[model samples]
Target: MPRLIAPGSLRRIGTFFSDSGYTREALRDTLELSELPWRKLRNLHFLLHKTQEATALHQLARIFYLGQPADEALLRQCIPGAIFGLMQDAEMLEVKGGVAKPACMVAPLENLVLVSDQITNMEVELLPDLVLLPNPTTLTVSRFMLRKRGANVFDLGTGCGPLALLLAGSAKHVLGTDINPRAIEFARFNAALNGIENVDFEVGDALAPAEGRQFDLIVANPPFFVSAERQFVFCDSPLELDGFSRMLAREAPKYLLEGGFFQMMCEWVEVKGQRWQDRLDEWFTGNGCDVFVIKGFEFGAAKYAHERLFEANPLHPERDIEIFEQRLAYYRERNVTAVHGGLMAMRRKAGSNWVRIEDIPHPPKECFGDDVVARFAGQDLAAWATDEQLLDWKPALTSRVRLRQELTARDGGWQPTMQRIDLVEGLASSLALEPPVASVVCRLDGSRSVREQAAALAAEAGADAGVAQAEVLRLVRRLGSGGFLELPATG
Candidate 1:
């Protein structure tokens, strides 16, 4: 294969893209290409009519973003001759019979233009080592990542290296490792294309490249699909039945320095007669880490097979039933009742560790790095502090917290029947609150200590002061674990 990337040439192509107004904002506004629900964005039917204009932006979108061929004359008219020559030398542009097209797909991801293999239409035709385009999961993992400056980060299974490249902006250094050599090539090319020097790519499975090295943060979007076959390196693990996820959970802590975090987007199977939490607990037990889990969604065996089949071959509806049956049979053999997908983060720490799980309706839309750090801190405090010790600590509601009440029409007036507290930003958690719980939450302003607040609440409710203090401690622990309140650390 010809070298499709050169340092200087990639820089020129980036300049060309910028000069042509090929940007994320323009793609979203003009072409309707967006970040979420990437299914609609991948189909070219909607863009066919929208890209009819002959502007440079539209032409670039057609040839690169939409994977359409452009006339050689039109390409010349749109791209600068110098840029065109550089692309040709780099083997990025393919010209045949006076029609020009991108040999690889180039699409805007946030502030970066990522290049990867053309999205394949056939599952059978997909090579085992194909480098994949940035999908919704990539965005999810990126949003879930903690952005601590000057940290040494690792991007495991870093296909195409988008996560590593994104972290390079703030990280002191980043090392990305992948099992696929083709993926490593694309990752290195992308790093050069973006002119990012702080990140490096290595070809290795799991953590082999980082042996004997410790990192401040490690993030992965590994091949966690619970598939029976290893057809795609980007999604299918060679290990059977979600063992890859288990392996990561079991071994990731070995590479993390004290207080460092390991975060990943993964899918795990829920076996018959076994709780998923217990299964995951087995993965992290005695690993010396405080774990946090977010279960975004779950699918029964049949539904999971159907979704996987459709994603593997969206164009071939006729083959769906056959492939679906095969996958279903595989799941039956493994006793997988359901498959759950979500994000998992583990912080390496000593002493009695805690595992907290949050069931979210969907993945968070914005970055919640600080919220994640705070939640870990809160969990640490809750796990170690005694009730009496917690009394001296001041707990405060998060800045964007809101209390909403459900009112019912009774006796010709509205009556509050239920109340819920919502964290408008960060984790975006909402939980039901009792009258007493609401009252306690409303008063936590970091002004008065928990002991004082408990006494006042006890006096008002005519309840035992000890019982009131216990309830307040329970509420504080729950809210703190969910990122709804800030608990200052104590000695």
Candidate 2:
């Protein structure tokens, strides 16, 4: 097994960089120990401190270890900043498995450092059952929400403080709260080690300290794991299956400012007789917030148990089939077919709270929740109105767009379409279109009345105007919700 570096050792390395010559000597020794091929080592040493160069080193080391040699000049071209300065700062160079990987170690600038193997061992000894690592998705989401909300931010379950640290970059005041004292200590130590002063970590449950305080953006990566047996401190929520979700739904609303957004990534067990959406919808009760639930990935109960259990005891992979079988049976007995994990974005509304549960069977490859965040921040649905807007406002069109309906088949056939259209003057327009034709859809033009556009379309079609009038009205309403057309201004 490869030796993992302890956090203490990493701190020592960070401290050692106070001496310039000592930093260079340490890099030289690390390069020697890695036994990297000469060309690779040369390029790494040249780019050791440069951010871009450090990135290249990581790439080159992977390639070199695979026995493939890359051009040193090309590698050097990727280095950022003066190579000499970076080389002198030992804190910037991280050695793992004997190969030097470029990393940012400036405490005040970028506080988080990758826990190399040496540090991983130290963390394991300190926290034992609790694993601490960066969760990129949570970090990305929290950073985005912080920027969008532009006020105070709260990170529940700070873990290693990745999300809190990222939030601190943008939020006015960032507070990270954790239930575990060890995690709180680690978070504070990490902040101090990285020279980040804006973030504050305190030992407290999710909504406890946040009771009186309200925030514009709240982010949490709570332990939403649903397990029959709990072993690890970080992975298992004290609340059983869906308990975290229940708690969040009940508590988060109290801390959110009016129209503030609460974004979280969680796991929920899919129970029989309940649609996942319905189960999630119930959690949004009483909070005057619009909820958007996106189901990202689903794993069978057996796979969920195995994956989580393996996380705790990865060293013992030789467990027998019988043991695995019993675990699968346990999941079956609980009626848990699968565990669904995904992003949940909720906005507290000033008026009635309506929850929209979208199965989101297929979310975009990238985070679409960011789009929701943008929409919430902009608060102007009109700005997002493009093709869909013109069509919805036009009262003359017959086909209306219904977002709830599936219009086209996967193989390219139009499914049964149903829509309700509204006229420019606040009257509901009913029209249906026959298959095999596409019609012009637009919003009501205040400059022209629906009657006039209908007359023009009738003349263009060269038919009795009444025949196509109803069809046009139907199309207009269908496109209305889709923002295809605009309604005429009312006095």
Candidate 3:
């Protein structure tokens, strides 16, 4: 059993972690044992292979992340003696098979180190509803969250409290809710471990615990994985075919203050006839919330199952094939075409809400919360702006926005083959420009209106100004909506 670390001991442990450079930002892709990075250790792969050098970080990682037993002497030497003693007293350090091993796994995300079961490290026993380390979805929602200070925040399905911990820094108060009692314990343990006081954990399911509650921001990484069966509360829910995710999208608006934002990571099943976008668009119907959906990589239903089952069957690879087939059959029986997953951001607007959905295959190298929030603001401006207003507004290209020319080698020399304009360092999106559109962009320097620039391009190319005007309007709308350009004056 994993016992809670005492508040007094948590401060000491936090100080030790800070001094040791034990952080997600510090260990990102740096903690390597054999061939795997630290983040990849989230998967239950056995990390019995240790590097030649035995630094404190390397040894601690072996004990904490890989769930391998460290010699009692070596553990005392690597970890602070007082903290080690505290952990031992709290039963966090267990002697299994005469070897001292950590009772739980610790994963670093931003400023916090989340504690959960080392299920992937298990060699024999298997059970459903096992707690998991931070996966891509956990990182995705936390990374994309808007960091609005002094806001009341809620983290639903807050497994191990990674998202809630991250939000506590900016939110005035943060509450994490989960149906699993163990998850509530883990989340609370992590909060005390990090000495974070603004967050409180509650054992509650979905929005039931949040009825009649209002928050300035509600951030959830709910159990939205599309599966025919519910095996785990973290990824699988009792709700059918993304019902829980749909409920959050549809009902979370009622729990938010006016103009408040609700962001979550979710998955949706694409049916035979209905498009995933259309289904998702319908989710926010009559909710009075403006939505922005950032679609991520999707897979055929079976492939998604195969990948998911791989994580669950880490200790029994031989059984993965069987489990995969079982999961795939369930999806096939339900007629799930493709399971689409992504980030959904919604704002509880008063009336006449809008929906913006688009595909974003690759995420940025790191989270830029302000940049993402600003994209929604920029979208609002571009969405409502008329062609005449756009021209009159004379939107200035952001400092980060730039144009790049792609050149190809010919028989003799390289020649410009394509022109692309995008936020060079902003929101990680782009706008490919044709000759005329490229010409118009070249002159969008806050120096000329769209109409004036279109006329200049028409004169230069001997084309109709009306044709140029219409084409430029289309390109500008795309550029603005996609965050390739922005109107600073409006802001």
TM for every model, in the order presented, reads: 0.94, 0.60, 0.90
- Rank by TM-score, highest first: 1, 3, 2
Q: What is the lDDT of residue 404 in candidate 3?
A: 86
Error of 3 at 280 (Å): 1.6
Candidate 3 TM-score, true structure as reference: 0.90
Best by TM-score: 1
What TM-score does prediction 1 earn? 0.94
Give the per-residue lDDT digits (tens) of candidate 3, residues 162-184.
88888888889998998888888
lDDT of 2 by residue, 261-367 (tens): 78887888778777766667668777677765555678887777777664444344456354567667766787778888877777777766545343444444333
Candidate with the greatest lDDT versus the true structure: 1
Candidate 1 per-residue C-alpha lDDT over 146-245 given as tens digits, one digit per residue, 9 for 90 to 100? 8779999999999888899999989999999999998888888888777888998999988889899999999999998888787778898668998998
- C-alpha local distance difference test of each model: 0.82, 0.53, 0.76
* Candidate with the larger lDDT of 2 and 3: 3
Where is model 1 more than 4 Å wrong at Cα? Answer: 1-6, 34-45, 121-124, 311-316, 410-413, 487-491
Off by over 4 Å in 2: 1-129, 136-146, 306-309, 320-323, 359-370, 374-491
List pairs with backbone clashes in candidate 1. Answer: none
Task: Indicate whether candidate 2 or candidate 3 has the larger TM-score.
Answer: 3
